[model samples]
Target: MTALALSHPAVALLLPLALLPLLRTSATPQAYPSLEPLGGDPLSAVFSWLLRLAGTVAIAALILGIGGLHLKGQTITKTGEGAHIVLLIDRSSSMDNNFAGRAPAGGEESKSAAARRLIKDFILAREHDLVGVAAFSTSPMHVLPLTDHKPALLAAVDAMDRPGLAFTNVGRGLALSLDIHERDTSAAARAILLVSDGAAVIDRKVQETLRAAFAKRKMNLYWLFLRTAGTRGISEAPPEGEPDTPQAFPERHLDLFFKTLGTNYKAFEAENSAAVAEAIAEISKLERNPITYVENTPRSDLTGYAYGLALLCMLLLALAKAAEVRIPRGSPA
Candidate 1:
């Protein structure tokens, strides 16, 4: 279906001017003294008509182009299951190690590499979900924003290329991820999937701010803990002496903190790539419940087509003039 729209609709009021060419009168008299001879030749008469018609068409096409015509169409895009997921990833040095709790050598797959592959897979499975990604070490770095464009999302995931600072600032990572959500006011389903093998203490004020955001937006938070072998996971309780500190059992303490946020929260602990995949698969199932969303198809400009048609008409007009048979004024030389 094709529809034409003018960028400058006001210019369309001048479209009547295109007809001025039809009323064209020669500023100078034609070489032929009278039109009586022109009528005797059928081909000559047809050529005159052809030339005028082509001129009219070229003028019309040019007018339309000046008016900025655009072909508009409607595309009914179904926004699949509504979930805006922001991947809050950890970029600490530990992420450079493999799932077997060993440091990666050249060309070896590390925790970050495996996580990236699995996350890319997860995105492929959730075709409708708008996802963003962020990475944190000393501070949070926003790698991507909430977008459903698969290539951009995958590229952003791949960009977590090297090990970051040794410190993990989960607070700043969470703050940045939530800020991405706040940027979009839509009430569509929201979730934050935090993938990290470590945790750090969050500031008290930031924690309060995060809790408010969680409650107001009614966000679902899932922590995918990629545990290193022999390290305490989310299920582990803090040591008796360091229960008050988040440093001793950082993952578990953070898990507890998440549970108190008064919004939907869950934690999944994974020690291997397979386990991480399984955790993402489980989250996939839980978030599949349908929610309404709107998709937009951008308008397309078609002035090039108009311009091309105009060019064709001008070429035909030139050819007709070139093939014209003109009578000799005096003697045939």
Candidate 2:
């Protein structure tokens, strides 16, 4: 089952629910026999059984009290309306490749830098949508959780520092984004926008598992492939393999990988800053589908139940103490 994602407003309202336990009383006092079994010659075992039953009820109450405390700490509720879009960015060492566009000093812009710019523009365009960022290299890393704070999310985008390794794990980033979106049950269509220049080098079994997981959520996967835009001077284009029928871009395996995304997926060839921004904006449009059903917020009034339990437990302990305190005087005849 998919986990529900709680909005900020819902979290704020339920945050206090965690502290209700500390405010209530401990336990109720037991009635002292009006006249202590005076001159009583065995009132029968019936009274003893009655006392045991009362003690059991009190113990149950204590169990209830402990449950109340547990409920408060992990309260989750659904709030706000609209679809959630998570941007899963690849921040492995390959993202640092300085080959998109170069300056006269022989230095070029990195793929991640381009991705950051595109994401910032996209966030500015649609600040209403709840969006998050996850940057991954060898493992998935959350740059920002789902939120409406555009500025903060953008900062997360900016914070995707390139790892020193020379490879990227595309699947890891995708899996993490899906996990986040699944938690937010209010989202209508959980969509992921992944920008990467290379395929994941992880094992095929792992990749298949990741693919199955994504399919289960029916997630919309969008891809923005960044490649060299053919600078007027540099001639070392990553070997095109004897130009097949003179196509604009030769049929690389990357095309097939993206084609697997099918209809919901839109593959955009963005080798420069402007195209990257356009592709992101286009995907944002698709991610804006309205949410149909909003789950009823969990009505956690377990506070009262908790207090009752504590009272019950205290009563039991008190009874036990009283039993220990009773001094036997040979039947008060």
Candidate 3:
């Protein structure tokens, strides 16, 4: 329900002036020596009352117009086919390199640039999804909150290509992405798309907290691992001589950690930009679900309508005055 409101409510203090028209008539008065033979005419009495009512209406409308009447803003719930998604992007300095682990040259695009382009296309395809963006290097940066606003989401994606810090703080970034989802109370399918060319060992304490959070909230998790040429993959096992540890193979261990969380997790190892695009397409196909979201409608102004009504009433009063009968001086009483 929408409620009526006023911009200048103080102007309503003068509303009592509308009653003045009812107290007195605008017609000229005629003198009479006696009242015995002069009887009230029914038609004249009705017409006089109508004119007073019109005058009252005009005054009341004018007061309301000055007060600046309007309807308050509203929030409407809508059903749509989309999920609540958070894009957790890696912004470490390594993302600036091409898939071959070198500076992009001769029309080659960096990993960050490819991710931005493909993510923007994904956003545009899901017209109804509420999306948020976050980036991680040495720390997590909250780029945007969950919203269905497309322009802002695209702008946030555009900022992901900026020069980044040295470290890949994956654990904190995941925590921030989960927090963004937690704050949104809407009933919808939840998913997190983590895009990175590499990973770092998560702290034990952070891993426990993430496990607890994941256990509490069931959501889809997708990792788009942009693997460079000759680099280790997420599922690759270490060589025989090297000890199997998170420090030696962080990507493989991170993938293992996600699997242990009991959420629906999938990892896509993309060797190039085309592979990344295909992985994003698969994720899009997987996340289609019914969602309930709230959309806000801005307030509407009714000042012009109020003034129009006042003008209508004044026009009626003017016509009544022109048709009024006048008694000449010294006419019979």
The C-alpha TM-scores of every prediction are: 0.76, 0.53, 0.88
lDDT of 2 by residue, 1-333 (tens): 333232222333444443433343223344455655465546534544444554454544444444343322333344433467788777766666644443213454677776777678877876357787887777788777878777798778777644545556666677688788877866366677777765544446755766677667777777777655663211224455754321323324334444554436667767677777778777866676655533434544454664675576556656655665444555464
lDDT: which candidate is best? 3
Cα error, candidate 3, residue 95 (Å): 1.5
Error of 3 at 280 (Å): 1.8
Worst 10 residues of 1 by lDDT: 24-33
77-144 in candidate 3: lDDT tens per residue? 88877899999999999999999999999899998899889999999999778999998999999989
A best-first ranking of the candidates according to their lDDT comes to 3, 1, 2
Deviation in angstroms for 221 in model 3?
Answer: 0.9
Off by over 4 Å in 3: 7-17, 24-37, 63-68, 71-73, 297-304, 328-333
lDDT of 1 by residue, 1-333 (tens): 556798888877877765664676212233655767556888866766666667777877887888888876565556567588899988898888887788977777788888889988999888778888888889889888888788998888887747567899998899899999888777678899999888877878988988887777878999998888787777666657765577666676788889899988988888888888899899998887565555556677777887988899789877765665576666655
What value does the lDDT take at residue 112 in candidate 1? 87
Task: Show where candidate 1 strays beyond 4 Å.
Answer: 1-20, 25-54, 62-77, 106-108, 238-244, 291-333
